[model samples]
Target: MTKKLIYNGTVLTMNPDRSVYKPGYVYIEHDTIREVGEWPQDGSKQALLESASWVHDAEGKVIVPGLVNTHTHLFQTFIRGVSDDMPLAQWLRQIIWPSSLAMEAEDFYLAALIGCIENLKSGATYIMDHHYVHTYPENDDGVLRAMEESGIRGCMARGGVDLSYEPKLRETEEEIFANTDKLLDQWDGAASGRIEIAMGPLNLYGCSRAFLEHAAKYSERRQLISHIHVAETSDQIENTKARFGLRNLELLEAVGLLGPKTQVVHGVWLDDGELESIARAKASVVHCPVSNMYLASGVARVPDMLKLGINVALGTDGPGSNNCQDNLEVLKFTACLHKVNQLDSTLLPPMEVLQLATVNGARAMGRERDLGSLEPGKKADVVVVDLRKAHISPVHRASSALVYNANGNDVDTVLVNGQVVVEHGACTLVDEQEIIRRAQARVDRLRAKLAPEYPVFRVVE
Candidate 1:
């Protein structure tokens, strides 16, 4: 029996009561947390330290539930900052579409490796990657291989767009299902169940009704989540309404897709009725604050969604849109962006924002019972953030320091399933420098393949 102990840290349980144990300790047996509370009253600490196989003194650090990222696209790591300052529509056509055609199988593997490392360094132990680009037959497989190698908890939302203008990016309903089935057969619940599969139909404009219905039925039958982008921009809302009489969520409902396991990404232009619809269906809406602001895609009604009893979670989106895969960065953005949007200082306090990333994110992934809190019997996915640093010190509130001040660099350690995958802010399973080098080579090669007019090749004056 492998036993591990992380003691002398400030523990944010993220439980229903929002418990915090200053100078607390957590005991893990195998892959589950066996005990976690304020330094115990019993004289078992010394005995535990002596008996545990691994021990880490977490003094001057804050231990948090591993951040859950409900949405992202790992394939974008190669083309992030290159396509900047463009709206969603133009960004898709000029950057993502062109890059999709240029990317090869190896490119997907390298992108997922670096993207997973970035998320680990950022204290994101659980990620729902909405990876949709499937230009090559082995592209998704390479991504799955990287996910397995990274040793982080992940859900690869295999994305398909049957209605895209870009032929290379489009897949027929049969192709989407066949590919999804193949991936599920090979990778679902692989890596000791750290990896999962989800059906990701791109969006209203990108997928046909027949395609969506097939995806919904397949995912529902398998008890997997159906993740999709919806109402991200005003133009999408108008376009979908024009093409189909119903709005994005309305169409999803018509196709029997709106349910508890549906993850609706970027509900930016949703109306009150639509918000209520999501709440009634018990579906989750992921808020990607940085991406929304980056694309000038208006802020999602996160606060209102929370008020309507909808499960609202946080995501960094794809790096192509967010420019980085740092979920911790999303935490700060979510707190500040919504407060400014609502013009209310008292709204979305630090603890509440933390919930959006932790517990709410777990709920979004249907793993709330096993993955969200530091409670006993939960998965031992924890992060230790060094709070003794310059920007985080004086030991105010752990939650405040985390959401308002702490960046990804503040993360000192990350553990997934009781395994120390990142120690001292570096990935343990793979050579970090090597991953970055390979990804850059792939990006350089990809850029060579794309036209000069693409944002990546445009030389800034």
Candidate 2:
């Protein structure tokens, strides 16, 4: 087996004790980390390093576990900057829904490729794509193909909305279940287990009670994780209460959807009792601070969630809303947003914010044991940040610099499953420029199609 060694850098283990080793080394054998610690002074270790197939000298760099984006819509990359400064309901109704209907299967593939390229360059190793824009079966296939080609670890939350206000996007209950079952059977554990499939009901506002009940039952029977948007806007809670006489979380609990294997996105408008119920069910919430802020959605009670021992993870939401897939930006925003909102600078420290992006995110995805931290026998998903930049010079504490100072553009090298996918801030697997060109071409066509009815937001380059 091929062995690789990365040495002579600051390694942030991000383990349970949050260890940091100056001028440390990590030994990797194929797809798993063999050892991670300070560089050995002994001759035996020196000899082993000399005999390795590949050695990466990470001098003047910071090595950390790859960031995880627990929730995002890959297909939304096509709709970036489409409907900004609008309310959530209007944005969804006018721009997002119409643009989604106009997209072909090829559009989804190109958009997903662009999203994956952005995520990789941003030091994100895994992405949970909550893709619910599939009007055709081929659209889902296109997304999976892009994930495979991009060589990023992906969780495809195959999504369907049974009660969408947009008629073209809605599906019958039987059709949605059939599509979900077919996708799971075909794609689960595909790409050498690099790809995972999860069940996703669009949301409480858009999916019927019967549909959610069926989704919950299917998830339980198949032991698959269930993901859905919850309490993202005040309208969602109000509409759910109006229809079912229960709040969003209450409706989810009544339909047997709240459990350890469920991940609720947003949760920005949840009350204290709802937070308690989520913590009690052992469920996780993914906080998308930038998206929430960009859309004018109120900040989530992240401090309250963390205080209650609920596993809170970080996400970028979607390219359409957030306009970027950079986890480093998300990390910084999570740290700063909570501090200011709570009126306490000590609320979310650098270490805790780092955890929210890495281990905590892994826990939310139920892959905590293998995917999160840097330890022996864990998957060698690693990112190397070049600290030689002027902005990141004279690193005080590696963790602090990583969260507060270093942006995603500082990411120099990235490895997923011990395979180097990005080097020197360039993707090794896909032609990034070509991907961008194709995505832009699709967007151009979409703008032409949308100009007649909706005023296309022209961005002058």
Candidate 3:
């Protein structure tokens, strides 16, 4: 029954009409937004403002719906800067796989904590974490614990690779399904409904056709979302075609995996027919521009996907791949990468890029009715960007400044579920410094344990 009022800010309501209110005020009652409109400066509403339990004066700030990171690997935070400037296959074979094998449940917990803190400070309210490094059952529990403690809302896509390309950390088909069911029983609808469990079969190369069909059917029956990496690299598509005589998307469709609730990450090498099939199925594609460019995975046909009526959302991929958990960076890169790739400056305007992170992301998560926009009756997940910074000063357009000029450090305050989780660019729920310290400690241990087996690559400065 606690009420709060945030007034005197530039509000970007990503509504259907894309309304922007200057000197706006958002009234909140507990976890829901009660009203969003221009601040009543006259004495007529002074009495109503005085009735709120708490009031936040957001002068010289821009308020928008909290940025949504539709896909990420929270457990990969430990592997940041470990394997860079390498192709996806070699990177996984040498550094990532070995490091994952040496990690324990505690390592996963600490890494997820660090990742969640980084995401929160970067104005992200929700993270669809694809945690596939479950060497043990406690590994799954570790990630869930970190998400709950970090106070961020998200879906935990418990991922597993059955047909392992690597030597260790492989589970059988029965074991994968049983573990997934255990996770669903324990974590689905947990964290006061802030965390949801989804089915995450690692990818086509790592999972069998039988496993994919089983995961899709289970996800549909349980009313959960199914997430997987699809056609991210050219090698994957070629290998799938070589093995099944079908492309990745064709295989998925043949197995009945494409649907509204299915989210395919990084559709970089898809064909025209595959794109049409995805749009027809009402499936979503999460474009990780930074990760794709960093891993040299080639650019996704985002414009083509959008033109075909496919729902496209933004993702940071993984901390290991992108080396940062900032959605602002993702937002800016999504806008710029397409324009340069397509050689058209008008493509992917600021408003459209911002929508990919907000409403489109919510649609990918199937929570469009409740989350995404700063509309009344929606959950009060909002971010306040301080525009007084040197880079963001002289703002001509709020949306333009948000996407182009501003970065994650400009995020001053973040509210998830009507509770302030970050204030003045720091997390409020967890000890961020301590999380970083512990995560680094775990990383050190992992590196030492795997050093003899996998030597570090030296770089000349």
Best by lDDT: 2
Error of 1 at 426 (Å): 1.4
Write one digit per residue (lDDT tens) for candidate 3, span 1-461.
97888889999999999998898988889999989988867866586478888787888899999889999999888888976789999888887888788889899899888888888888899999997776766988888899899999978887877775774766787887888788888888787788889988888887778888888888888888889999999999998898788899999888888999989999999999999999999999999999999999999999999999999999999987899988998888998999999899999989999999999999999999999999999999999998988898898898889999888889999889998899888899998888788887878788778777677723223
Candidate 1 has which clashing residue pairs, if any?
none
lDDT of 2 by residue, 246-332 (tens): 999999999999999999899999999999999999999999999999999899999999999999999999988999998898988
Clash pairs, candidate 3, are none
Worst 10 residues of 3 by lDDT: 452-461
Which residues of candidate 1, in runs, are more than 4 Å off?
40-44, 451-461
Query: Residue pairs in steric clash, candidate 2?
Result: none
Model 1 per-residue lDDT tens digits across residues 1-461 = 99999999999999999989988999999999999988765666788889899988999999999999888999888888885789888888888888877788898889888888899999999999998887787888888888889988999998888885577778788888888888889999899999999988888887788888887788889898999999999988888788888898899988989999999999999998899999999999999999999999998988889889999989999899988977778888998898898899888999999999999999999999898999999999999999888877886788999998889999999899999999988789999998788788777777776746565565455
Instruction: Report the CA-based lDDT of candidate 2 relative to the real structure.
Output: 0.89
Ten-residue segment with the worst summed lDDT in candidate 1?
451-460
Tell me the TM-score of each prediction against the true structure. 0.98, 0.98, 0.97
| Segments of candidate 2 deviating more than 4 angstroms | 41-44, 457-461
